[model samples]
Structures are given as C-alpha cells and as structure tokens.
Target: MSNEFNDEFVKEIPDHVRQRLDQTYEKIRFQSKKKKKHNIWMRMTAAACCLLIVGIASTSEPVKAAISGIFKFNDSGIEQAVNAGFAEETDQSATNENVRITLDSYFSDYNKIGFSFQLLFEDPTLLSGKVEWISLDVRLKNGDGEYIVEFIPDTKPLYGKSDYSVGVHVMNPIIEQKTGIAQFDTVFDSTEGNFPALSNAVIEVESINVQYANGEFKKIDGEWNLPLNKAAKPFEVVEYVARESDKIKIVKANGNPTSLSLTISIDGEPTETPFAIMKVVDEQGIEYEAGSTNMTVKKGYTLISTTFPISSFVHAEKLQLIVGNEEVELTKTND
Candidate 1:
C-alpha cells in the first residue's frame, strides 16, 4: 500500500514543473512592464509632433494677415475714382455719361468732315471694379441748329478698359445744286451751265457740344474754314506787225530755232527796234544776231538785214526770240 501511494504522488508531480511555472510568471511581468513603457513613449512622441505642427501654424498666420491688410488699405482713393470714372465713361447704357471727342477734320457746310474721336478711360481697381456700358448724346453746332451725333459701346459684360469711336456726317442746303436750271435747259452750253460759275468758295466750322456725367451738356468751341479757287483757262495768242525798213542779220549762233524769222515783239515794240539779239534760229540752223542799229519809233516794226546772209536759218515754221531778257514767239508770214 505504501509503495503504491508513493508512486501515485511521484506521477502527480512531474519533473521541472516548478521551474516552468517560475519562468512563465517572469515572462508575463516583463511583457507587462515593456507594454507600459511603449505606451508612455508613444504618448510623448505624439505630444511633441502635435506641438511642432501647432507652432508652425501659429507662426505663419501673421504674415498672411499682414499681406491681406496691405492690399486692403495701401491704394489711394484716386485709383478708385479713376476706375469708377473710366467705367462710367465706357458704359454705353449709362445715361448722362461723359463722352470723348477726337477731332480729325472740320468742314464748313454744316457738316462734320473727317472727325474721328475715342472715349477715354482709366485703370480698374479693387475699389471701383470695371465699367459696363455708357451712353452719350452729342450735339454739334455753330450758332445754327444743333447737329446730333450719338455714341454707344458694342461690347458685352462691360469690364476693364474700353472706348468707342463715333462718326458724324453733316449736310447743308446752301451747297446743293439748283435743279431748276436742268429742267429749264437740257442742252449743254458752256456759257449757260446749271452750276454756279463761282470764282472762289468758302466754308466754316464752329463748335462741338459734349454731354457730361451729370447730364449737363458743355460746349467745346472751335472754328475751321476752307477756301477754294477756280481752275485756270487755256492760253491764247496775239499778233503784232513790224514797220522798220533796215535789214536784220543774225551775227552769232547758239542754239537751234523753229523758224527763220520770228515775228515777236518786245514789250509791244516792233521787231525794227535795235534790240539786243541774244539768240536766233531758222528752220534749218541756229544763229545769234548782233548789230548796232537804231529804232525809228517804239511802235511795231520789221527786221531786214542788208549785210548778213539768210541761208543760216535754224528753223522755218516758228522762231523763239529773246530780246532784252524778254522771250516771244515769232511766226513766219506767207507774204
């Protein structure tokens, strides 16, 4: 019985049982302590990272606020006014807006001629924004009834810088032709034309009226005039006869002539006068006539040479004769 009880007790208590229990307890305690340390380190690291992020966020806020403030207050009210003014100036739909006029040219017959102009505008700003549309009623006058010209912008969503160009045409009744003469006489006659044979014509231009932003119209006064002259007539010819008896001779030769003897007179004086012959030419050749001779009278005269030969004529039909700085054309007579 005693041996059986001892064997049962030994079987219940296996070898190394106590040692295994002790090692298991030690591992559990070490693991618990390690877990606690790891949790504490994680909390500390998270707190430090949060502090760094918050510090960066706090330091950057003031710079953003300062930049925003500079943009808000630095620009003067002038920029605002200018922007508004420009918007108002370009707004074609706006009533009583300021208009711009660029003068190109002026005509006198109650008509604006070659007049080109543009509306002006200023830069846009945060205060004034942009212009949308503008309208203006312009009147041009010169103590006569007012001539009207309107301007409107053609753009949509009116914004930024903008301007418009307007053209005006003026017409008057004084410059119109008379239709009565054409109906009365259809035949073409140089002396009885329907148009006025005016020697000279004059035109005048006066003032321009501009409407401002306040719906008030202002007068910009100016004057322009144009004078026109008639065209010249074609040239004509006159004749004079020479009465001298002395013979004329060409002494020197210079250039070719169209006629042998020129029937030209100097200051209405006949060719018989002892004029200083500068150049003479016949139909075939040119010769300079020089001699000491006197004139009987300052009236019409003829030239005949008793000493010089007549065969040296430069031209036969017409003669260009120069006497005492005066030039005249001489035609040969058949007689």
Candidate 2:
C-alpha cells in the first residue's frame, strides 16, 4: 500500500512504455462521448498511477507495484486485461463530511464491469485496523432509466455478508488495511434473464460501508455515480442450448482482455451450476477458459454469468462452449 515509486521517479518514461500509454490513452480519449465521459482526469493516485500509463515495460519497481494492484484494483488478473480496453479514466468524486471517495477508472463488456476507487479519510484515526468486512448498495439503470440491477440494502437484505476475515476479503487485504489513503478494485455482474446487451448503464454507489475486526466501522452515505459504455457488441453474442432443458439457454460470450463471460436463461429456477467454467475450444484445437458461471434468479427465466482472468483474448477465431463433454458452437464472440 505504500508507494515507494514517487512521481519524480516516473518522470522519465521509457520509450516503449510511453508509446503504449500514448496509444491506449489516445484511443480511449477519442472514444465517442455521445455516451459516457471517457474524457479527462484519469490522474493516478500515487506513483502507482504510472502503471496505467506505462503498460508494464519492465521488471522495474514501479511496474511491479502497479501490476500487483491489477487484481486488487480489478476483479481479473492484469495479464488477462485486453490492451485495447484500457480507457482514460473519467473520475467521479463525492465527499461527505470527512470522507471522500473517488471513482478512478472503469470498463464493462456484456455482463462484467470493473472499477477502481481511491478513498481518503480525512480523519484517519476513525479507521483503527484491517478492514474485516465490506459491501455496497448498488443501483444500475439504462438509458430509458429502467432498473437493470437494483440491490438496495435498505429495502432488501442482500450483499450484506461480505466478511473480510483474512482469506475471504475482497480487495488486497494488505493494501486495503491501512487508513487515510487507500485504493480498491471491484466488479459487478449485469447479465439477467438472458437480457440483450445494454445500450448504456448508469450505476450509482448509493452507499458504501466498511468494518474492522476491532469493532470499528466507517461509511459514506450518498450517491457516487458513474456512467459506463458497455462497448457491447450485440452481433457478436453466442448462443448455446442448455444441458438441463431446451428452454434453458446459455447466451453470449462477452469478453475483453481482462474478463469474459456468458449468460444462461431458463424458466423458473436454473439447475446449472453458476460458478463452473465453460471450457472453450478454438479452430486450431487450442483451448481457453471462457468463464466460471455466476448467476441471479428472476421471475421469468433465471439468468447466470461468470468471468475469467484471460487477459490476452478479446475475440476468438473459432470457438466452442463446452459444458461437461457436450459442445456447442459459438458463432461470434463478443469484443
């Protein structure tokens, strides 16, 4: 959590790293903002911010520190992130009394969304030890303002058991333990009832809460919203009939460099395991881990989704979704 690499040390960027940063930064900067603000203020929190800029050119101290945060700051491994998906951060900030939370940068595909945030507790003493538990009240809406996923802890009692007992923690327990200034990475799943790709999603952190083993707790109650362009490729979605029932269908393979996943749809409750990976085979007989299913049940057809840490894959040449020994053709992979 301590940043040994200062901004001064990062002043001299290597030619290769600089080139990669520029390429990624420009593409994201020029992305059509008719949707979301992929605009400015992607400034890094510390010298580690340089990681988002340098693109891992070497084994230097700065590169290692930043890359190590890939998992802490994101749900997927850094090696799995697509180089093209790197976006210039459009930070969204909100302050409540002595607490300030900044939504650093975020990205989304069909079902998975990831974001990084920096929290500054003006009253550092309020936090005494390691953050033993954490959770958020998230509300997501589309362009027409339809509620896509609304889990408000006040009305419902879900997402309330995020315990941080060492191994079961969310963020890097080591880095997140400290008070005052700290950063965290998180992801949200949006595939429900085999719904089509979202046009645009506006998600708001209605509230954030954290707890410690030492009976200490802290929270910031208010809206910390960010708009996301899913970059959804509707035509690229793939379909697979379920092993359990024909009515139950596994839909779409949405992916970027960092994460990949598919959605399952069925009437009533779904019987398929949501966390199991759907093995994929390519044209050259190459194999890749597509996703481990994560799901949510709804009124009509229950839907499921999951993501993998496959960083170097964006789209597949020819792919197949394998559940057990059964194989299904995926005509197009999401980009």
The number of the candidate with the highest TM-score is: 2
User: What are the RMSDs of all candidates, in order?
Assistant: 50.8, 14.7
Q: lDDT of each prediction vs. the true structure? A: 0.22, 0.44
**Across residues 108-185, which tens digit of lDDT does each residue of candidate 2 receive?**
444444556666667766554544434445655666666544434333433222211000112422223234555555
**Model 1: per-residue lDDT, tens digit, 1-335?**
00011232112212233233222222211011211111111111111111100000111222112111110111121112122221111111111122122222221111011121222222112102111111122222222222222111122122212111111111110110111000000000010001122233322223333222233333433433323232212111122232332243232221111112122222333433344444444344444342212122233433222111122122235554555555544454443
Leading candidate by lDDT: 2
TM-score of each: 0.16, 0.53
Which sections of candidate 2 miss by over 4 Å?
1-79, 133-135, 154-179, 191-202, 223-277, 282-313, 328-335
For candidate 2, the lDDT comes to 0.44
Give the true-structure RMSD of model 1: 50.8
